[model samples]
Target: MSKAEKTRQLIIEKTADVFNSKGYAATSLSDITKITGLTKGSIYGNFDDKEEVVIAAFKFNAKRLRDSMDAAISKEETAYEQLMAMLNFYKTTWKKAASQGGCPMLNAATEADDHLLFLRDAVKDNFIAWQKKVSTIIEKGKAEGSFKVHLQTETYAYTFIMLIEGGILLSRTLNQITHLNTALDRVKLIIDQEIVN
Candidate 1:
């Protein structure tokens, strides 16, 4: 990458945690500079404004989370096992995410709902994309005989996403892992009793 490109990425990397943790509206220019140690001229030299930095940082965090989960899911031999792996992966990785300021997508979505209108569509698109991934997995499971045929892939996909995100929200807010575990447990139960043949 060019020097400017590398610097841009550096800024995003440094600011990701602050953006995810403190959020877009609340994160000030000083916060970005504090985390990144970049002068205002250098930051403005790379991006248009703090808005650009927040968006880039949020995307970086979301992509990192997605890549990690995708890597875990890819290790399983079957679609059923893959779904289970995802649940377990969440249980294992959530603490790390919480420490970094909870799920980036969840944090962005919550902030976008009432405050950051600029981020609303990006967060919406991310949710839609995630649901599509889950639906694709359910479809694969059906074809491979791991999941029951004729099940509503879209519905199951939506439920899984909802359960996971809801669980994260409650667990992070309540400072209790059981709420997240219970939500994940519910997802597994649904898969076992309803989705599996």
Candidate 2:
């Protein structure tokens, strides 16, 4: 990468945690400068404005989440196992993430409601992509005869996304991981009994 691109990426990496923690409305350009140790001129040179930086930071955060889930899911042998692994991965890693101010999708959705169209569109796209991934796994499991063929894979995928995202929001709001665990437990049971053959 060019020097400017590298510097821009560095800024995004450093400020992503702050943006995730502080929310878009609450986070300022000064916060990015503080975290990145870059001058206002340098930061503005890389990004057009605070909105641009916020969008980039959110994309960085979303990529981290997607890559982590892909890694964890790729480790499993069976599609059923992969599905369970995806659900369990969230339950396991969510605590560490809670300290980072919770799921980026939820954070972006909450903060960008009715504002920041670009950021909200990005989060929505992420959710749609994730749901498609889950649906594909479910379809594979059915074809392999490891999952029930009668189940609605698309519906299941949507429900899985909703449950997990909703659980994260509830857990973060309540300041307790039990809500997350409960939601995940339900996810486990749903997969084990409804999907697994």
Candidate 3:
């Protein structure tokens, strides 16, 4: 890309962890400059303000998590297997998130509540997208006579998201992985009983 765009992306990539670890309000322009080795002029030249950079950095981190999940899910042969694979992926990857701040949706939702409309919208959209993906898999399973036709896909999708996100939050807060593992095991059990024929 162009030099300006490249610099902006570099800033986002470098500061993603900073924003996540420090939160938007606490992360300063100096932190961005320190991480990116870019001058204040270069940072301001590309982003309008700290808010803008925080939003972009959050999006960057969130996209990385989403892409990883997509890759893991795509490797499975069936919807049920895919769902299980996703939970397994979460169990393995979540430890790394401690250093990277935390789960993006959980971090954004807590920080953006009743403030930062753009960030709130982004988190909401991420949740909706995730639900839609789960629902699509459920529907596919139903069509293939794998999942029960009587199942409510939307509710199941929402519940699944809630469990996973809540699990992450609780596990992180408690500084224990067992909570996450238990939650994921429950998720796998639900998928097996509800989605597999």
The clash numbers for all candidates, in the given order, read 0, 0, 0
Tell me the RMSD of model 2 versus the true structure: 1.3
User: Tens-digit lDDT track for model 2 on 1-197?
Assistant: 99999999999999999989988878887887889999999999998988899888999999999999999999998898898899889989988999998999889987777677768888888888898999989999988998998988889999988888888989999988888888888888899878899
Which residue pairs in candidate 2 have backbone atoms (N, alpha carbon, C) closer than 3 angstroms, thus clashing?
Answer: none
Candidate of highest lDDT: 1
TM-score of 3: 0.94
Best-to-worst order by lDDT is 1, 2, 3
TM-score rank order: 1, 2, 3
Q: For candidate 3, which ten residues in a row score worst on lDDT? A: 114-123
RMSD of each: 1.0, 1.3, 1.4
10 residues in a row with least lDDT, candidate 2: 110-119
Please list the residue runs of candidate 3 whose C-alpha ends up more than 4 Å from where it truly belongs after superposition: none
- The CA lDDT at 96 in model 2 is 92
Identify the superior model by TM-score, candidate 2 or candidate 3: 2
lDDT of 2: 0.89
TM-score to native of every candidate shown: 0.96, 0.95, 0.94
